[model samples]
Target: MCHSQDRTPSEVGRDLVQWFLENQRDLPWRRDYSPYGVWVSEIMLQQTQVAAVVPYYLRWMKRFPDVPSLAAATEDEVLLYWEGLGYYSRARNLLKAARLVMERFGGRVPDTEADLRVLPGVGPYTASAILSLAYNRDVPVVDGNVERVAARLLDLDVSAKSPEGRREVLRAATQWLVPGKARFYNQALMELGAVICTPAHPKCLACPVAARCLALRHGTVENRPVRSPRPRWEELRVAIGVLRENGKIYIQKRPEGGLFAGLWEFPGGKALEAETPRVALVREMEEELGVRVKIVDKIGVVRHAYTRFRVTLHAYRCVPDPPGQIVRPRACAAWKWVRPSELDLFAFPAANRRLIQALRKAADAGS
Candidate 1:
């Protein structure tokens, strides 16, 4: 109900920076503080939790240490390193942007906001994060955590993702950051939100800026960082086939620029309302691979969600018919036949990975 004009920006900034320096988590990206590290970490962190990103980051940095290394790698190999991290497009874009960095920016992560924004998948928040965190620019990075912190501290009247709300947060950040301390200041604000000023059950007592938070003073801490209503989940029934011949499974690399673009997936499609999953798998196999398959057994089912749709995937173990077992690939960028144990050579979507686990489990049990 009350606006956030009571506390001075400098006072809050001093407390946040001091607290963050002493409390920031020991993350891999923080250890090196290189622009390449910051860029990779920021992109990997998108729509993914920090805990989940750590291992992936470690592996990625090991494999592709610099922009040139990343640029040299093939897209499939890049996605292989980024397999479990959902949002396949992030991996794809990272590869594209890495090549662009090599071609356009002379193998350096762009320092200016404009140049950074032009990279594939680099948006306002990402650009700001790179500039401030890597280049020490006096720019603000207002991600979800920072938005939540700013909304509570500044008592934003609109949703944090809204344009006006972002402007309000940037205005507050511009006034608060100390000279030559943009990196620490931005990290502190985000770290505070991550650990102390959490979305639910915030530790107001532990928060260094608790005394200055207008939302806390007004008893609106729980409802401060208002967000728009999330879109309804669209339910889908998907059927995928783990078609095997001579002990190796068949998988397809999807063509560029569609749902799950360029990622590997088992052959199959949506099940009609009246048809069972087996029927759908058989139909898809005949249609896509130019062969008829016999549904040998049920492998497993996986549930996955994208931004707007949730899918219950049914995975079936299938083998081509004895006589007409010739495979002719269709509607795919590429196709591969590899042993189940050798599946790590290619990248697959989340559901397919789960299917692989179930496949292994079944094989183990059978043996």
Candidate 2:
């Protein structure tokens, strides 16, 4: 941990920007340097893959279109758009930030990282990215990709899981910043880390900054950076897929406080001991939907991964002998009987998205 003040943040910023101008990848967010676009993309990118995010981003931008639109939207609406993306908290935060922008900043996004940090869910990396990219401020954006790149490039043996370790990595990355070209430099470093200096196999030879990389030169690109122990695995038994009536889906809105909040989901909960998944679905639907459903057929099973747990989603196609009127549970705000054609308007979980396709296929096949 050397704090050589000799390497000014501005000088390093300039070099990185020069590298960025020639190497930066063309991403949608890069098309326009606006805080609204940056804010949306950064929030969407949280814990989500770029490939998965592309369609969502496009659809989201089309729907909201601007900061004022997002700010004016309801929580349920925001969650609907962000459905299937997981981590509903990010959607909640986006709304909060948008409202703050409207109220505190005259509906205009802030330009400084400090002011941006005060908004909900805008942490150090997001703040830096918004400031540097949208405002051309000289700040280092150290995301997971940037962290991996920096740690391996410098061959630093620090625990990435710890606060102090993260701070050191951020400091090191900022030391390499290229001043006036903050946006390009930050995006370039991110792209290089994402495409070339990957976790499993790094194409060191193809890396532009390989000559200055201590890890590449010393043959420690793969094994240089060490992290804390892997995340603990937890198992979740989730009951899903609320099938009701003829060719209609029954969905319950999630509470606005926890994971999957505000999103529409099939009414089912965790299966208990001595309780089969089907039985659990029956009980949960009754509890959550105020309707009793008899398990007609098991659609299929789905395996989904969350940030903290692995879920085994048991999807079943059930029918109510005498359909009870759709009602919202205490945890839910509303219920909807959405036709298959209009399923796109409602937010669903990722795994359940595939399940819906399967259901449609089953219906088409007269199953």
Candidate 3:
């Protein structure tokens, strides 16, 4: 609604930074201020909450503390560490970037913004964060929390993801970013939004820069940072064939460079609007595995949600029609038959993990 930085930048920056120095949380990343730790923490924090990221961040640092250590890890092990975090592509890209850092940057996280931008997962925001927080570069960073603080401070109304909104927020941030004080200023601004200036029911009284917030003065704090609504979660129906023979279960690795890339999953696909899920299972097996399968029985259903889709997986127990056929993978990377007890060794999607758990429970009940 309203616009302008009515308060002095020096005054506001001092108050925010002072408050931060006293109240900032003792996060693991902040404990050392290492470039590697900052980069990993920033990537993990995207689309994830601080509380959820803490334990995962801790475990990840313990296992792969530096660029060289991470570069040496297998993709499967990286995915395993990232299992429940969701948006697994982040983890994949992070590992890719780590290897690149070793080969291209001499096993050191790049310091220049341009060099950081060339990495797989490092974008403008992430680059700025690493530069400012890790290298003590005098560059201002704009993440969700920082954007929120800027929006309320300047009463910005456009979507933060949009170009115009970004420009406006950056303008406000630069104004308040004290020279050579980027590390403390940026973190302080974000901390203010994360704690006192939250989207819902902001604690205006406790905010360090409350006197300077245009939205608070204009009585529009709740509606200051406008964001476009997320796309509706479309319901996606899928079928998976869990082929079992001689106490071994069949699983296939997904082709690389797509969703769930390189992860092991049962072969199956979506049903045509006119066909049943079982019908889809037979077709998928023939197409993906190059074998005709008879759907012997329904296994179970598992529901999982991604960023844009809510998937309902219908699993089936299937057997090759001819009892034995040459195994071939037409649409997948590889195929293998493992004992049911060995399923836990492979990294699977959350939905497939649920199916595995159910099957394990059934075997336990029968035994």
Candidate 4:
């Protein structure tokens, strides 16, 4: 295997920049570059495809145009814009970071790497990306695509998931970064990886840096940049209760600092072993809302797959029992009752979204 020293950094930089200028995709974030736009796009791009994030990013920019605008918006309003984008913590952290930027940095995004790192959800990769891409700093970014391209180019033997492998890839990327041209060079590297050096069936022939890629010479381009095995998927059975009273459905805000944080959902929880869906719904509603409910009928089931787990949601139509008490927030942060037509004002998880649609349809049919 050849080391990164085999190829000259200047040569790689020139080729990459030239290729990028000629062949970069016309993305919205690339046009009229702003630090806020770069930060938001970077967060949204995490674990989400480019095609999916494009429209969402456009909508977010329109609604929350600047850091002050984002900080001024409510959490519910922010999540409403980010409803379908999974990994909701990114949205929440963006809100936190925007507020911090307003208070700490005087409403302007921090330009220095150190200050940027201290912002919520702004890690090393994200910090480097914002500094280099938005501010044109001489910093290196080693995202998944960059790591894969660098590993193949340097023919690193270790998996990118390992610390040693990550360091080596970052070193290679840093060495190749063109001084005073980080904005273009980093984007070029990522663009090259996305279009040519893909994980499967990489188009090495079309790659601009094919001549400098060590894996190509070693006949191991496809096998380079190995990753560790993914975690096993855990199956969960959840019971969601659609409790209604006076033409309003009951919903609760999830607690902060966990999965689906700050989003709204039907009152429910994971079913215990051997517990029936009906029993689980009753227990969960009582525990979450502090109100007793009787199952009126079974609604429908919705299945959703998260990054690490798959859940089967059993939904049921329920009504508050006699001597209905004021719903209290026991397990959640807040509780509310809203008409089916008003659900769009709040953000809900994908599974709960399906349930909401079902409820709306049922209400319409009954009417």
Q: Rate the local accuracy (lDDT) of all candidates.
A: 0.87, 0.78, 0.88, 0.90
Reference-based TM-score of each model? 0.96, 0.89, 0.92, 0.93
**Cα lDDT of model 2 by residue, 166-224, tens digit:** 87778777777765767888887788778888888888877766766767766777775
TM-score of 2: 0.89
Candidate 3 lDDT over residue span 103-221, tens digit each: 99999999999999999988999999999999889888888888888888888878776889988878778888888888998999988888888888889998877877888888878
Please, what are the lDDT tens digits per residue for candidate 4 over residues 85-182?
A: 98898998999999999999999999998999989899989999999999999999888899899989988888986888877887778888899999
Q: Per-residue lDDT for 126-173 in model 1, tens only? A: 998998998888877777888899899887868877878877887888
Q: Candidate 1: lDDT of 117?
A: 88
Pairwise lDDT winner, candidates 1 and 2: 1
The worst-scoring run of ten residues by lDDT in candidate 2 lies at 1-10
Q: Candidate 1 vs candidate 4: which has greater lDDT? A: 4
Residue 150: error of model 2 in Å?
A: 1.6
Point out the worst 10-residue segment of candidate 1 by lDDT.
1-10
**TM-score of candidate 1 relative to the true fold:** 0.96
- Worst ten-residue run, lDDT, model 4? 1-10
Q: How many clashes does the backbone of model 1 have?
A: 0
Candidate structures ordered by lDDT, highest first: 4, 3, 1, 2
